[model samples]
Target: MGAPVEIRGLSYAYGSGDLARPVLREVGLAVGPGEIVLLTGPSGSGKTTLLTLIGALRAMQAGSCRVLGQELAGAKEAQRVLLRRRIGFIFQQHNLLGFLTARQNVAMALELDPGTDEAGRLARAGRMLEAVGLGDRTESKPAQLSGGQRQRVAVARALAGDPGLILADEPTAALDRQSGGEVVRLLRELAKQRGVPILLVTHDPRILDIADRIVAMEDGRILPTEKAEPAPAA
Candidate 1:
């Protein structure tokens, strides 16, 4: 099965009455399996908002959003929760539980599924952390890890569920250039290897070269997809 995401005429608004303001307008986009789509825009350009919508963190206020063929526009609360478990999400902030170890944080995702056994969940979490280069730090708390490592742990947690779609919001914003590049490369590799579609929201141009396609946004509207120039051969 392919990882297909479709958003049509999507719109989102904040506040109410006279204070209400729209954040997105008529936004439309589609991402296929194994596609690495980079969404770039300045702060308040609705990039994060768009990601939140795609991740089912917020309700669809207008238009339609379908992930893996399920419509999100009018989905009930329970349905949204179901969709969330199927979609992985990485935010700018690591969002790890402070008191929990990295391995525990990753295992939390699997706990939602009744079919997951305790041993299998831990094994899967450990393997995912190792894949993201955090194998040795599985027992460490978020406070003990570096910024890049924390982000990697977050990535590992996202992948623990074996989601078909991954949505990342400025995941590398807190890391150094080299670390950020490495993280992007890891995400691309995961997408390619697992046939998962990745929608990354970031303002950094440094990692743009690693994306399969770039979608620029302005004032909440998605610009056309542009082919990014290839990186220099190593």
Candidate 2:
């Protein structure tokens, strides 16, 4: 199956009527399986807005945005929730539960799926943490682990489901150069390993080499490359 995500002429605004402020304008993009599409732009360039729309965290305002082949032009709340479960999201903040251990935080992802038991969840979470090189810190709480370790735990949690699509927002923004590169390498390896597509919104030039394609945005539209062709996939 193709990796989830297809957008065409997508536009969005924060408010309604005259008070509305446009966030995206005629944005079109596609992410194929096993591809890493890097989205780069200045702040307020609508990169995050587009990522949220693809993650179904925000409803589509206009145009075609089919995720996992399901049209999201006017999808219902229930539909959005279902679509979200099939995608992995890595945020710049890490967003780990402050009170939970690294293992518990990762296990929380398995809770979203109905059939996984407690034992299986823990086992899987442990393995994912291990994969992220945090096997020894699984029992540490967010406060106890270093920033890199915490972010690695977040990565572990995001991948627990092996979602067909991954949406990452400046995942390495807070880390040092080495830590950031390590995380980017891990993401690139995992995405290709399972043939999952990743849409990473980042300003870090250091990680650009990890992407198969790079698309830049300004204001609210995707900027065309020097070739005068759309940088985004159709």
Quote the positional error of residue 45 for candidate 2 in Å.
1.1
Report lDDT (Cα) of residue 121, candidate 1.
88
Tens-digit lDDT track of model 2 for 134-233: 9898899999988888889989999999787899999999999989988988888887778888999999988887888889999999998422222232
In the range 134-216, model 1's lDDT, one tens digit per residue, is: 89998999999988888888899999998989999888888899888888888888888898989999888888887888999
CA lDDT of every candidate: 0.88, 0.89
- By TM-score, who's the top model here? 2
* Per-candidate alpha-carbon RMSD to the true structure: 1.9, 3.8
Determine the C-alpha RMSD for candidate 1 after optimal superposition of all C-alphas.
1.9
TM-score of each: 0.93, 0.93
